[model samples]
Target: MLTAAIVAILVTMVLALIRAFLGPTEYDRMLAANAFGTKTVLLIALAGHALSWHSFLDVALLYAMVNFIGTIAVMRFFEYGNTRDNEGSGSTP
Candidate 1:
């Protein structure tokens, strides 16, 4: 039963990864990537239980935090249109 669940999550993660790569828009890609991350967390947790490895849970938690922060940072970057300026610029406003 646990094996089946893990397999299903893995399949969905693959689908999400495809969507992230082939999505029509930036938002769609980001959303798909987010879904992929979520599925990954689920997969890690399930596999950890199935294999009796407790450390996987901690790794999953860390991955979740990174995923959330990365999504937010990407969104902000798109919205702000590159807030970081190049150092080669000769003048500052």
Candidate 2:
């Protein structure tokens, strides 16, 4: 069962990669990339179980957090042209 799940996830990840590369718009690619990351997390968990890896949970959780942060950073760049917020940009004292 776990093997089947891992295979399915890998298949979707490949599809996501294709979308990321062939997507017409950056937004579409970003979404695909995000999906790829999510699928990776699932794959990690499933594979860990199948392989009996004790540390898979920790690794998957960390990777998931990284994926979330990376997606947020990419969206911020698209929205603000940078990661840093320009608070109180009226004038610098």
TM-scores of all models? Answer: 0.85, 0.85
Off by over 4 Å in 1: 83-93
Listed per model in order, the count of residue pairs whose N, CA or C atoms clash below 3 Å is 0, 0
RMSD of each: 2.9, 4.5
* Each prediction's whole-model lDDT (CA): 0.90, 0.90
After the best TM-score superposition of candidate 1, give how far the Cα of residue 79 lies from its true spot, in angstroms.
1.0
- Residue by residue across 20-64, what tens digits does model 2's lDDT show? 999999899999999999999998888888889999999999999
Instruction: Kindly report which residue stretches of model 2 are placed more than 4 angstroms away from their true locations once superposed.
Output: 82-93
